[model samples]
Target: MQQMITLITNSISKDLPATLEKSLKKEISSLGPVIARAITPIIEKCSASAVADSIQKVVGDRVVNQLDKSVSAKLEATVARQIQMQFHTSVKQTLQDALRASLEAFLVPAFEQSCKTMFEQVDSAFQKGMSEHTVAIQQQVEATHTPLAQTLKDTISSASSITQNLTAELLDGHRKLLALLASGNAKAHSTNVLQPNNVPVTGPPEVEAPLDPMKELGRLISERKFDEAFTMALQRSDVSIVSWLCSQVDLRALCSMVPVPLNQGVLLALLQQLAVDIATDTPRKIQWMTDVAMAINPTDPVIAMHVKPIFEQVYNALLHLRSLPTTSPSDSTSIRLFMHVINSVLLSYK
Candidate 1:
């Protein structure tokens, strides 16, 4: 059977091409119309309603869905932006209120108190400084006032005497002028002169006496004749002449009266005199010490150490006086404290 099947396949394969060719020719001749007929109804149906209507429905639905999505997205974005802006505004307002409350509750009161304290401290310091200056000024004024008062009293007395002298001189001159008018000068100078009272006089003018030396000195000083007045005072034998002159003259002017590079001999003589005075007047020892202190112009201990000339001079004078045979050990001990007090004041300036 396998042999018979192989033989039949060979025979059919040999005849297949011829038969197939003939059949294709016949079918091909009728195939065009048949294909046209089969496809025409489907093309017509698609063109008439199915394809265009379905396409329109699908495109419209897609467009409507896309528009809805776009509108929804825009609305959502606007709402979100409004929400964000509202949230920021609300938070900003809240923070501002909190900051204002915190500052009012905490910082403002503390700052005001701090300012008040600073102002009070400044005011107190100013007052204290002013009070100290006022006290110092008052002390200086008191120290100088006695001499100034004496000078003023002397000036008033001198003025009264001058006025009396001038009155006597004027009356004498009037008598001489009347006598001249009565004798020879009246007609000669009458055209140039006016006589309001037209009263006659007969007495001759009297010569004026020379002024007192003290009065002359006072007048010279008042006239600013400082050098002449100072020389005059120095020449006077009066023990209180210097004190009287000091009442009228400035301390600087008095100091100027001493020759420059001050005469050490004169200074020593003055010191010796002061020492004698202080020794004799035991009650005024402290006052002498104060005068010495004023002359030294004391400074801090460090500065005093560097510039010790004046202090040394004062110390040597004190030492020399204390070493005198008249000074007892008890007196030396008591006087030693004055030096110590001066030294302490110098150190305190540091």
Candidate 2:
């Protein structure tokens, strides 16, 4: 039976393709129109709806999602920028506030204290300097001021008289020498005071030779040999000569021509002499002395050292002037300082 079935399957497998193909072509051709008519509208309707659903799902959902994503990103960026701006502003404001607070807390108080301290120091110093000066001057000037001024006047008059006598004597000697030369006697100019018999005269002759130390000083000063004149003036122990030297030597010349340290000594010595109440040269002395004081070099230890001594003498005279009712001006710091530098220049020459 299996052999019969195998034989039959082989025969059918050979015939099946030819017969089935013809019939299948015929059936498909006949059913194609029927299937098209029946299912085409339904398929077309379902396809249209499917395409609409697909478009809505794909395009609309994707657009909404993209818009949402973009909006979120932009919002995030704007928020970040705002936060950054706020943060920066906060930091800057904090720094400024801190600086202001620090200044108010520390720097302002320190500056104010420093200013107050400085002003207080200045006030105290000014008072101290003035008071000490007053006491010292009061102690030093025991004698009446009138006598000193009167004595200065007398001394000046005496000096003038001596200068005149010396000058007259010089002129007379010149005249005598001229007369002798004209008279053909050449020996008249000689230092010897002898008679025609060549013997020494018994008594003092008409015009004695002048021996003025003051005159020698004038010569040195006039010759610009300041150092020598300065030395000679300082070395002389005589009060009158020192006074003479003090009255004569210009402080300006002393400062300009002489070397520093030496000039300092000369200046201090002159100031000392002026302190002795020589009212004769007050007007001349005050102006330049004030200028010298104003121009004082802070770095000069010698000049700085000499200030107290210089002021002692100057204020001595100033205090005396104050005591005199007629010449007393209002109490002024400048006036006190000015009147302290005392005396006149040497004008013994003419």
The prediction achieving the highest TM-score against the true structure is 1
Worst ten in a row by lDDT for model 1: 188-197
Q: Which stretches of candidate 2 lie over 4 Å from their true place?
A: 1-211, 237-262, 291-306, 309-313, 328-350
> What TM-scores do the predictions have?
0.31, 0.30
lDDT of 1 by residue, 211-258 (tens): 576787788788876544543443332325534554565544344453
Residue lDDT tens for model 2, 260-280 = 423433444444433343344
Distance (Å) between predicted and true CA of 337, model 2? 5.8
Quality of model 1 by C-alpha lDDT:
0.53
TM-score of 2: 0.30
